[model samples]
Target: MADGTWRPYRVLLGSRLRSQTTYRRSFAMDLLGSLSVGALEFGEIYVIFTNVDVLGELDFAAAALLFALATICFSLADMVVGHADRLPTYLRQGTLDAFLLRPLPVLAQLITSDLSLRRLGRTAAGVAVLGVTLPHTGITWSVTTVVLLVLTIVAGTAIFAALFVCAAAIQFWLVEGAEFANAFTYGGSYAAQYPASIFALPVRVLFTFVVPAAFIAYLPTLALLDLPGPPGLPSWLGWCSPVMAVVMWAVALTGWRAGLRHYTGAGS
Candidate 1:
C-alpha cells in the first residue's frame, strides 16, 4: 500500500524481464518451440472437429476461444512461478538451503529463480488466437464485456498460480509425488481448455467443489458467452473466479509456510 512497498515489487519484476531478455538466442529458440507446439496442438483439435458438429454446446470457434484463454492463463502463470514448481526437487537436493539464506521473501526468491522464456511464445499465440476468434463468436462486444474478459483472464492466471503453489506445498511431504500433483496443474489446464461440463459429473464436481477450477475458465466463459449454466449456479458466480483465486492462494501460502517449518525441522 505504501510507495516504499511498491518499489521492491517493481524492481523484482524489472529484474526478471531483463533477465529474460538477456538470453536472446535461447529465448528465441524457446519461443519458436512454444509456438510450434501450440500450433500443433490446435491443429489436431481442428482436425478432430471436422467430423463432429460440437463438443457439447461449444462449437469450433467457442472451443478455440476456450483453448486460447486457458493457454494464455497457464502461460502467464508458468512465466511467473515456473521455478516454484521445481521447489520440490530443489528442496530434496539441498539446493533450497541457499535460497533460505537470502534476505528476500522466500516466495519472491523462489519465484524469481527460474524463468521459462518459451512460454512467451505460447502466451503470444494465445492472444493472437483470441484476437482472431472473438469477433466471430456472436457475443456482442461492449465496454462491459471487454472489462469482464480482462477480469476473467486475470482470474484464470491467479487460479493457475495458486494451483502451482499448492502443488509445491504438497511436495514437502510427498517429495516424489510431484507427478501426482501434475494431475491438477497440467490436467486441470487441459480440462479447462474445453467445456467443463463435457466431463463426467463426478469429475465436474471435483474441479468445481474441490479444486475450484471451474470458476477459472468454465464459469467465466459461460458468463462471457452468455450460455446457460448448471441448475442453481448463478451468472454472478462467473465473476467470482478472481476472488476464488485469492482464497486458493491464501490457503496455499498457509500450506507452504507449514511445509517450510517441517523441512527446517527435518534438516536440523
Candidate 2:
C-alpha cells in the first residue's frame, strides 16, 4: 500500500518484456508485420490526398503529424496495458483467481502481464515519421511548444488507456468480449490519425463528448500546428487534453472497482 512501492510493478513489467524478447524470431516477424501495416495505412491516406489538396484546412504534413501522434500514443497504450483488454477470457476461464491472489492492484497486474513488443515497431516508425513531418509542417517550435508536445503524447496515451480499462470493466457485466467497445479504442485511434474536423458532425461530437478523444488528438494538433479549428472551438482546448486524460482515468478506475465487486459477488 505504500506509495513508493513500485518495485513489484517493475518486476512484473520486466518479466513480460523478457518473455516477449525470448521468442526473438517471432518478435522480429511481428515487428516487421506491424511496420508493414502502419505503412499501408499511411499509403491509403496519401492516395486520398493526391486528389485533394486539403482536408479541412490540414495539409499533408499536418495530417502526417496527426497520424504520428495518434500512432505513438496508441502503440504505447497497447504495449503497456494490452492484457487488460483480455480480461473477459481470463475471467471466464477462472484465470482471475491468480490475479486475485496477488497483493498488487488488479489494474497494475493486468497492465504488466503482457508486453506487446510489436507495438514498439509501430512506435519507432511513428517517431520517425513525426520527426520527418514536423519540420515540414511549419510549426514554430519554442520551449513551450516542445513541452506541450510531450504533454500531448502522454495525455493521449492516458486517454486511450482509460478507454481500454473501461472496455475491460464492461466485460464483467457483458460476460464476453465486446467488439463494439473497440470503436472507442481502435476506432478512436484511427479517427485521431486524421484531422477530426474532416469527420462529420456526429462523429466529431462523439469524439468530443462521449470519448473526449478530440482533446487528445485534434485540439492539441490544432495548437501545435497553429491551424484554425471549426467554428466555436476555443484555442485553449488544446492544453486541456492532459487534464481530460486524468479525469477519464479516474472514471475508469471507479468502474473497474465496481466491476471487480460484481465479479466477486456473481462468482463468475
Candidate 3:
C-alpha cells in the first residue's frame, strides 16, 4: 500500500500503457471496435424494449440502468484482469516460473503486465447509458442512493475481477480450460446484463448463488428502483454486493493458492 512499494508496478503498467498507445491508428481502431460491440450489445435491449413495454418488471429506462451497471463493471474488470486468461500460455512458455522468481507477487505481476486501453470504449458506452437512464428511472436521489450507485460499480467490478482470477487459477489445473473458464467469467458478464427474473429457477440459482452474477446489476437495480425481486431473491439482496465481492475474492484467492501448490511448471 505504500507509494514506494507500488513504484515497480507503476513502472510496469506505465510501459504497457505506452506500448499500447505507440500505434495511434491501431489503438483507435481497437477502441472503435470495442465501442461498436458495446453499442450492439445494448442494441439488443433497445430492440427488446421496442417490442415490449417491460421485461422482468423493468421499463426501458430501468432496464437501461441494469445494462449500464453490468456493462461498466464488466468492461472495467475485463480491462484490468481479463489478461489473466493468458495464464495457460504463460505456463506453457515457462513465463510463470519466471514470475515466481520475481520479487512481486505473481498475481500482481500478471495484473500489471498489460493494460487494455481499448476496453475504455466499452466503459464509455456503459457510461453513456447510465447518463441517459439514471435521470429517467424516476428514482428520488438521496445520499443513500448515491452511495448505493457508487458501491454497485465498485463491488460489481470486484466481483467480475475476482471471477477472472478464479478462472485463471483454475487454468493451472485444466491447462487448456479457457473455454471452461469463459463459461463463468465471460458468461457471467452476459448474464449480468439481464434481469434475474427473466431466468428460470435453475438458471437463477446458478447465476445468483453459484456465479453471483445477479448481484452485479439486477439486484442493485431492484434496490435502486424500489422494486421487489421475484421468488427467492429479495430487494435487500442488492445491498449484499460488497459482501458477495468479498466472498468471491476469498474464493478466487483460495483457488489461486491451491493451484499454485498443484502446479509443477511446464516441464512437468
Candidate 4:
C-alpha cells in the first residue's frame, strides 16, 4: 500500500522482462500463437455474419466491434492481471514462503511472480480488429463519445482484473485449485464478446447479476452506440461501466482480504 511497494514491483518487472527476452524466438512463437487463436475466433464471427446481415439486432460490423472491444479490454487485463492465476501453484509448491518473508505484500509478489508477455499478442489482435471495424461503425465522432469509450475500456479491464483476483483468492482456501474459476474468468470473457441478448435468460442473469461481466463491454457497447439496455436492466445501466467496475472491485478485494486472512500455508 505504501509508495515504496512499487519499488520492488519495478525491480521485479525489469528482471522478468530481461529474463523473458533471453528466449526471443520462443517468445515470438508464443506471441504469434496467441494472435492466431484470437484471429480464428474473430474469423468465426465473420463466417456467421456472412449467412445473415444481423444477429442480435446489430449488424455484423457492430457485433464485431462489440466483440473487438471486449477482446481489447480483456486482453489488456489478462496481459498483467492474469498473472494472479499462478497463486495456487505457488501455494502448493511452498514457493509462497519466500513472499511471506518479504516486506512487500504477498499479493504484490504473487502478481509479478510470473508475467506472460505472450498474452500481449491477444491485445495486438484486438487492436487490429478494432482498427478495421471502427471506420465502418458510423458512430459519430465526438469528444464525449471518445471519453466514454476510454472509460468503458478502462472499466472493462478493471472488472476483468478484479475477477482474476476473486478467482485467485479462492486458492487460499483450496490450494489445489483446478480450472474451477475458469467458469467465470475465461467463460465471462468469452460470453462478453458479443451482445448479451443472444444468450438465454438464465445466462444473462448469471453474468449480469452474479458475475457482473455484462458491464465489461455488453452494456458499455450499447451505450457507446447510443442504444438501449436489454430488457430487465435499467436503461441507464449501460453508461455506468465505471460504477460497475468500482462495485465489482470492492467485492473482489473484500474476498481477497478474507481469503488472505484465512490462509495458513502447509507449514501451519
Clashes of each: 0, 0, 0, 0
Worst 10 residues of 1 by lDDT: 259-268
lDDT of 2 by residue, 1-268 (tens): 5645988877777887899889889999999888877777778778988989888788888888888888888889888775677887788788887888889888888887887878888888788889999999999989878988999999999998998998888888887547767877888878778777877888888888678878777788899977779865665788899888989999899999999988863365
* Model 1 pairs in collision: none
TM agreement with the true structure for every prediction: 0.91, 0.94, 0.98, 0.94
- Candidate 3: list runs displaced more than 4 Å: none
Per-residue CA lDDT of model 1 for 117-168, tens digit only, reads: 6688889888888888888788878887788899989988999998888888
Give per-residue CA lDDT, model 3, range 1-268, as digits (tens): 6999989988999999999999999999999999998999999999999999999999999999999999999999999999999999988887799899999989999999887989999999999999999889999899999999999999999999999999999999898767899999989999999999999999999999999999999999999999999999999999999999999999999999999899888773
Tens-digit lDDT track of model 4 for 1-268: 7768578889998898888878989999999998987898798889999899988777877888888888888888888779788888777777777888888877777778767788888888888988898789887889977997899889899889889998988878877754898889999998888788887899899988788778887787677777766688654676788887888889988988898888677673
* Model 1 alpha-carbon drift over 4 Å, by segment: 1-16, 232-235, 265-268
Q: What ranges in model 2 sit over 4 Å off?
A: 1-4, 265-268
Rank the candidate models, highest lDDT first: 3, 2, 4, 1
CA lDDT of every candidate: 0.80, 0.83, 0.95, 0.83
Scored by TM-score, the top model is 3
Backbone clash total for model 1 is: 0
Q: Which ten residues in a row have the lowest lDDT in candidate 3?
A: 259-268
Compared to the true structure, candidate 3 yields what TM-score? 0.98
